[model samples]
Target: MQRRIIIAGGGTGGHIFPAIAIANALKKIDPETEILFVGARGKMEMEKVPQAGYKIEGLEIAGFNRSNMFKNLLLPFKLLKSLGQARRIINEFKPQAVVGVGGYASFPILRKAQGKGIPTLIQEQNSFAGKANMVLGKKAKKICTGYDGMEKFFPADKIVVTGNPVRGNITQSSVTREEAAQHFGLQRGKTTVFAVGGSLGAKAINEALHPLLASFVEKDIQLIWQTGKPYFETAKTAAAAYASHVKVFEFINLMDFAYKAADVVISRAGALAIAELCVVKKPVIFVPYPFAAEDHQTFNAQSLVNKKAAILIKNDDAAAQLGTTLFSLVQNKALMEQLEENIGKLGNTNADMVIAKQVMALIG
Candidate 1:
C-alpha cells in the first residue's frame, strides 16, 4: 500500500512554511508517497500550497475572535461544522499519518486522526505552546518544537527538539553583498538596514519608521522597508524625499536576496521570521508585536537577547530608540560580529531533513 499523509493547518508563514518544508522532505524520501493539504478556506495556504505543487482542500474554519467576542458567538457551530467536514475529508484521504502545523484547521483534523488511531504529529513554532497544540500534544505520537522546556506541556518522551524548518533558499542563499545590493537597487558602498512588518504588517512599525526616514538617511544608512499593503501609500509619501537611500515597498517577494543586502535588520518577531534570521546570521533588532497571543513574540526575542544573539527593542520604544539603537549597532563592528556568531550557532539548516527522516521512521 502507498504511504499517504495528511498535511493540515496554516494561517501564517510560520505555520505554512514548516508544513511545506515537511511535505518537501517527505517527498524527497519517497517520491511515490501521497500527500494532501487541508487549510482554512479563505486563508493564504489555499493559494500557496497549490503553487508549491501540491493538492489542497479547504475547511470553513475560523479561530476565536479576540477583538470582537460577538463575532465568535457562532464559533461553536463553526467548530461542529468543521469537525464534520474534517471527518469526511479524512475518510476519503485515508492517510496513515497526519501532521498539524497549529492553525485553526489543525485541531479538528488532528483530533479526527487521533480518534481513528492513526499517528499524529505537531510542529509547534512558538516559545509558548499554543492551547490547540498543547491539547493535541497530549496524545500526539510526536511533538517537534523550536525551543526547549516544552516538556511542561507535552509528553517529554514524545518530544523532539527539531528546530523550526526554515526555507532552504533563505537558509542556504548564496547571494553576495554586492549582488543583493543590486537586487534592492541600493548603492554598493552604503550600510543597508532591512525593515519588515511581517505578512499582515504592523501599523505601529510603519508609523514609527515614517518620522525616522530623513535622520536615517542623514546618517548615510540605506533602508529596505516593507511597508505592507495598507501603509504603502503613506510610507511612500514619507520616504519620497529620501528615495536616494531608501527603498520602500508594499511587500518584498525576494527576501533571501534582501537578507544578503542588509547590514542590520529590524522586524516583528514572528516565529518563521526569527527562524530565517537565525539562518542568515545577521545582526538584528527585534520589535515584538505587543498584541500577539500571550506576548509570545517577546518571549521569542528575549531568548536571543539573553544569549547575546540579538537585540530586543519593545514595540512601544521602536520610534524613540530604534534609530539610535541601530546606529550604535552599525558602528560597533565587534558587537555586530558577536551577534552574528552567537545567532549563527542556533541555525538548523538540516532540520527539515532530520524531521523528514523521523517521519519516514514512523511509516516503516
Candidate 2:
C-alpha cells in the first residue's frame, strides 16, 4: 500500500517553505507516497502548495487577533467548524501520518488526527514554540526542531534536532555572484546588499531602506530589495531616481539567485530565513521582528549572536543604524568572512530528509 502524508501549515514563507521541503523529502524516500496539504482558506498556502504540485484543502480558520480583541469573538465558533472540516479531510485522505509545520490552520488538523489515533509529526522551526505548537507537541510522535533545547517544548524522547529545512535551489544552486547579478540586471564590481522583509514586508525595514536609497547608489552599493506586495509600488516610486543601482520587487521567488548576488543581507530574522542564510554563508544584519510570537525571531537571531555568528540591530533602531551597519560590513572583509564562516557552521543541509525519515519510522 502506498503511504499518504498530510502537510499542514503556512501563513508565511517561513512555514510554507519548510512544509514544501518536508513534502519533497517524503517523495524522495518513497516515490509512490501520496501527499496532501491542509491550510487556512485565504492564506498563501492555498496557492503556494498547489504550485508545488500537491493537493491542499482549506479550513475556515483564523488565529487569535491580538490587534483587535473584539475580532476574536468568533474564535470559538471558527475553531469548532474547522475541527469538523479537518475530521472529514483526514478521513477521506486516510493519511498514514500528519506533519504540521506550525500555523493556525495546522492546529485543528493535527488535533483531530491525534484524536483519531493517526500518527502526528511536528516541525518547530522557531527556537521557541508557538502556543498552538506547544499544545500540539504534547501528542506529536516526533518533533523536528531547528534548534536544541526543544525537549522543553515537546517530549524528550520524541524530539529530533534536525534543524530547519531550506529550499532546493538555495542549497544546491550553481549560480555565481556575477551570473546572479547579470540575471537581476545589476552592475558588476559594486558592493551589493540584499534586503527582504519576508512575505508581507516589514514597514520599518522599508522605511529605513527608503531613505538610504540614494546613498546606496552614490556609494556604488547595489541593493536587491524585496519590498513585498503591500509596499512594492511605493518603494518602486521611491527608488525611481536611482533605479539602476536597485532591484525592487514585491517578491523574489528565485531567492537562490538573490542570495548569490548579495554581498551582505539585511533581513527580518525569520527562522527559515536564518536557516537559508546559514547555508548561503553571508554576512548578515538581522532585524528581529519584535512582534513575533514569543518574540521568537529575536531568540532565533540571538542564538547566532551567542556563537559570534551574526550581528543584530533592534527593530526600533533599524532606521538609524541599518545603512551604516550594512556599509561597514561591505567594507570590512574580515568581519564579513568571520560572520560567514561562523554562521555557516550551524547549517544542516539535510534536515528535511532526516525529519521525513523520522516521521515514516514513527508510523511504521
Candidate 3:
C-alpha cells in the first residue's frame, strides 16, 4: 500500500527548503509515497514548494505580532480557522503521518493532526527551538534536531540529532570552480567572495557591501552577490562600475555554482544557510541577524566560531568591519584553509536520508 504523508511549515527559505528536501527524500525511499505540503498562505513556501514539484495546501494563518499588539487581536481567530482548514485537508488527504518543520502554519496543522491521533514529527533546525516547535514537541511522536543539546528544548528521549536537511544539489555538487566561474562570467585569477543574506536579502549586509564594491575590484577580489529582491537594483548599480569583477542578483538560482566559485562566504547565520555552508565546506564570515528569536543566529554562528571553523561579526559591527575583515581573510590563505578543514568535518551530507528513515519508522 502507498504511504501518504503531509509536511507543514514555511515563512522563510530556511523552513521551505528543508521541508522540500525531506519530501524528496521520502519519495526517493519509496516511490509510492504520496507527499503534500501545508504552509501559510502567500508565504514563500506557497510558491517554492510547488516549484520543487510537490502539492501544497495553504492555510490562512499568521504569527503573533510582537511589535503591534493590535495586529495580534485576529491571531486567535486565524488560528482557529487554520485549525479547521487543516482538519479538512487532513480528512481529504488521509495521511498516515504529519510532519512539522517550524513555521507560521506548523502549529495549527500539527496540533490538529496530533489531536486526531496521527503520528507527528517536528524538525527543529536551530540550536534553539522556536516557541511554535516547543509547544508542538510535547505531542510529537518524534523530534528531529539540527544541533546537539536539544534536551534544553524538547524531551531528550524524543529528540533525534538528525542535523538539518540541505539541498541535494549542494551536497552532491560536482561543479569545478573553473566551470562555475566561467558560468558566472567571472575570471579565475583572483579570490572570489560570495555573499548572500538569505532569500529576502539583509539590508545591513547590502548597505555594507555597497560602499566596498569598488574596493573589491581595487584589491583584485571577485564577488558574486545575491542582493535579494529589495536591494537588487541598488546592488546592480553598485556592481556596474566593477562589471568584470562583480556579479549581483536579487536571487541566485544556481547556488551550486555560486558555492563552487566562492573561496570564502559572507552570510547571515540562518540555520539553513549554515547547513549549506557546512556542506560546501567554505570558510565563512557570519553576521548573524541580531533579532532572530532568542538571538539564535548568534548561537548558531558561535557554535562554529568556537571550533575555529568560521568567523563571527555581530550585525551591528558588520558595516564598519566587513570590508576590512574580508580583505584580511582574502590575504590569509592559511586561516581560510584551516577554517575549510574544520567546517568540512561538521558537514552532514546525509541529513535528508536520516530524516526520511526516522519519518518512516515513526509512522510505520
lDDT of 1 by residue, 122-148 (tens): 888888888999899988998888888
Quick one: best TM-score, which candidate? 1
lDDT of 2 by residue, 109-228 (tens): 999999999999989999888989889889888888899988777889988899999999889999988899998999998888999988888988998999899888788889999998
User: Could you tell me how far off, in angstroms, the CA of residue 241 lies in candidate 3 after the best superposition?
Assistant: 1.6
Residue lDDT tens for model 3, 1-364:
8899999989999999999999999999999999999999989998999889999999999987767899999999999999999999999999999999988988888998999999999999998889889989999999999999889888899999999999988888899989999988998867999999999899888899999988987888899999989999988887888998899888988899999999999999999999999999999999999888888899999999999999998898988999999899989999999999999988998998999999999767
The TM-score of candidate 3 is 0.97
Candidate 1: give the clashing pairs: none
Comparison by lDDT, 2 against 3, better one: 3
Give Cα-based local distance difference scores for all models.
Answer: 0.89, 0.91, 0.92
Q: For model 2, which pairs clash?
A: none
- Each candidate's number of clashing pairs is 0, 0, 0
Q: Model 2 — TM-score against the truth?
A: 0.97
Off by over 4 Å in 2: none
**If scored against the real structure, what TM-score would every candidate get?**
0.98, 0.97, 0.97
Lowest-scoring 10 consecutive residues by lDDT in candidate 1? 354-363
